[model samples]
Target: MGIVNVTPDSFSDGGRYTDVDAAVEHGMALRRAGADIVDIGGESTRPGAERVDAATETTRVVPVITALAAAGVPISIDTTRATVAAAALEAGATVINDVSGGLADPAMAGVARDAGCPWVLMHWRGHSRDMNKLAVYHDVVAEVRAELLERVDDAVGAGVDPRQIILDPGLGFAKNAEHNWQLTRRLDVFVDLGFPVLFAASRKTYLGRLLADAEGRPRPVDEREAATLATSVLAVAAGAWGVRVHDVRSTADALAVWRASGSPRLKTREN
Candidate 1:
């Protein structure tokens, strides 16, 4: 999956594709770069980012999704609001990538059921503005898995098709650097849950901290592509269903190399 942030304040590559035409072109570029799906988000879910009204988010993302879908690109609406998801689906989006994991809106599950499309349930404790304060975990892996299962149960109970649900560990949403690495290291556990797992660690702050400079300063966002590629390769190797990334071509190249090295397990498969 490739990311297309149509908001002005996403942590990485925000404001670069807010225009409908630019966003459509970028989505096409991602498709050309070998992305199976292009996820477009109108709201900035970056840590400490403020929320956008539902109408504004719908306005920002609908036209882009419509254009991309019209051009034959697979599109996922990256939003938590049911109204926004409904509008994007009406505009031709095929998937809903809800970072709130059905917790933010009571109507999200119904929307997914009505649309009959895949819904990505990311592990989230709260909204972005106050999410950092909710990052408490004793055993990060165990807790995340358990929480994700709870989400699954809730979504299933809410009438979402079990087969259409995908799980995302939501790296850096409310997690600290340690928690992020811990989740990455234990990715297989999430994969073992019998649901498609989406690893979205593209250019996040945790990677920057991991690749800190000699002076201990975190690496810049653009400089984190190497780390992001490494994470994508490792995630694929660990049986993750997919990875949501900003730099699609580099990740595609890395995956090709990994497969060419004769690792049958690294062959891409749908989860």
Candidate 2:
């Protein structure tokens, strides 16, 4: 998966693609660079970010999704609102990458079920505004797994097909740096949950902090590609089904190398 933030305030590459033309071109470029899915998000879910109204969100992403879909590029709508998801689907997006894991909107599950497309349920505690305050976890790995499973159950109980569910640990949504690292280190646990896991540690603040300078300033977003690439390769090695990344070419190239190395099968639950 490749990320295309159509909002003006996403933590990384925000204003760069707000224009429909630029967003579509970028999605096509990512596809050419080997992105299996181009994820377009209209709202900025970055920590401390405020929510955008459904109308604004719809207006921002539908045009880009429609243009990209017209170009034959696979598209995923990265949104939590059911209305937005429905519009994006009608506009040609084939997947729903809900960071709220179906918790934000009561109608999201129904939209997903009716659409019958893949739904990415990311582990989340609350909305971005207060997520940082909710990042209290005793055992990050187990808690994230349990929470994600609950989301899976919610999705399933809402009449969604279990086979269409995908899980994401939500690296920075409500996690501290250490929590992020713990989740990444134990991603195999998520993979073993009998659902395809999506590892999306692309240029996250945790990676920036991990690679901070001696002065304690975090590494810039663009400079975290190397660290992001490492996470992608390691996630694949740990049996993650996919990775959401900013730089499609580098990650695609690295995974290609791993495949050339005879990517060994990792243990996973027999769902």
Residue-level lDDT of model 2, residues 155-240, one tens digit each, is 89999999999999999989999998888778878887789999999999988998999999999998999999998998999889
| Candidate 1 clash pair list | none
Q: What count of clashes does model 2 give?
A: 0
Listing every candidate in turn, what is its Cα RMSD in Å to the true structure after a full C-alpha superposition?
A: 3.0, 2.3
* Tens-place lDDT digits, model 1, residues 1-271: 9999998998888889998899999999999999999999999998888998999999999999999999999999999999999999999999999999999998999999988899999999999999999999999889989999999999899888999999999999889999998888888788888999999999999889988999999999999999999999999998889999999999999999998997754433236
Alpha carbon lDDT of each predicted model: 0.92, 0.93
Give candidate 1's TM-score: 0.96
TM-score of each: 0.96, 0.97
